[model samples]
Target: MSMNSHAAIAPSLLARIGAPVRRRAAFLLLMASLGLGVLREAALGDAWRRPVRAEFRRVLREAAGGGFSTIAVTAALIGLGLVSQAIYWLGEAGQEGIVGTVLVTVLVRELAPVLVGFVLLGRSGMVAIVELGAMQAGGQLRALQGMGLDPFRLLVLPRVAAFAVTGFTLGIIFVLIALLTGFVAGSLLGVVQLSLFGFLDAVLRAMGARDFLLFPGKLVMIGALVGLTSTITGLSARRGDSTATLLPRGFLRGVLAVLLCSALLSLAV
Candidate 1:
């Protein structure tokens, strides 16, 4: 072929490949949003509905358990991070007092949401994806159709609710623990006043609602996105080589969604 024709053909081929990829991605996101909507609708459902109450209770229980486990893991990670910061600042005089401020900034505004999101993205998001993927591979999703059940309601709603609640709760707990750890470290090292209440007051004043609200909002958005993305990706998983590709795509898409939402929210606030 002529060089110009070859170049044109290459562009056309690339566009053809890109189009389906983009469509699939968009479809995945659409499905995730639908999952969130389903959860919202269920929450607004009947007051006298026994099934709704049972589902709500089950979701809350799962969220509490997940939040507790997430808190322990987040605390350990934040503690390690704080210790590293303390050691680094130890060599510099007159720098220890700022540790409390640093901790508050990191924990309340940045680390907590991102860390909790990542934890859920890995734990809940991945698990949902794998479970659904396995089901898809095993024809279980089709089986649900045969049984006249909407898989999104039965499978995806509970998870979306659980992840959203767990993520927001864990984010709050992570910030609280990080603040306490920073205060104790500073006091022990004589870097800050020994009063916990005083430190907390300072943090509250510095953090205003803008900083505090941004992280929690981001956590909720991340949870919602993770639930949606994982479910759609899992549902789309086909047998053979396609399943492997779908799994990683789901994870990377979840991470990117969280980062994008967090950044936008932070900027807007």
Candidate 2:
């Protein structure tokens, strides 16, 4: 190909290549705007009317309903693998004094939020994607709009709030279970000699004032991000989108949101 011919074709090639990139960027910006809109609407008391309240309650139940068993199982496993192992190794190293520090810093502060976020994403986020994607595909969203309903107010706000609440709830449960399980395992293995109250005291002592604020805040943010990203993914579904496409997209986005929020919070604190 001559240089002149190549130049003529380059623009067309570039346009084609850039189209998807631009579309993705624009979609991300739209989602960000929608997230902000949800936050704003949720802040207003008037937005918590009967319909919105009902939907919020239903979504909350559906999202967090079976959370106890899942959290318990996951927490026990994590305690066996993470907490017990850390305590045993630290005790062997004669650095048992810092067990609290290590647990708080590594497991409670970091792992708990991320793990709980993933649980919520798997348990409820994918459901949101499927439900909303189906509604979008079936034109139910349009029908609701025609019926003078604001989908964002009715759907997005409550769901996001529920997710946030669920995230915090699960996160706390996760921390307690993991810690207690770890303590029990450690005691059984002869790695922990302290009483349960003493072990808890050590963990509490290791935590600073900032940690009290940061831990819960991290959980809330992780949950909100997962919920927001998944919801946005579903709501943005087009006519061509199906379960296969929406599910993976929502999962990836939710995972990224959870990690990113955790990292940012870690850096900030």
| Candidate 2 residue spans exceeding 4 A from truth | none
Q: How much lDDT does candidate 2 score?
A: 0.90
Query: Estimated TM-score per prediction?
Result: 0.81, 0.95
Query: What would the TM-score be for candidate 2 when compared with the true structure?
Result: 0.95
Error of 1 at 39 (Å): 5.9
**Who wins the TM-score comparison?**
2
Kindly list the per-residue Cα lDDT of model 2 for residues 48-159, writing each as its tens digit. Answer: 9999999999988987886768988999999999999999999999998999999999987899999999999999999999999998888999999999999989888888
Q: Residue 122 lDDT in model 1?
A: 76
> Clashes in each model (backbone N, CA, C under 3 Å)?
0, 0
Predictions in order: lDDT? 0.71, 0.90
**lDDT tens digits, residue span 1-269, model 1:** 79999989999999999999998778867865786576566566642255544664675575556557767766766765674355347426566456556655666677777777777787667767887888988899889889986676667676676677777877777777766665566556665643789767766666666766776788777777777778777887866835568768888978887787777887888
Give the clashing residue pairs of candidate 2, or none: none
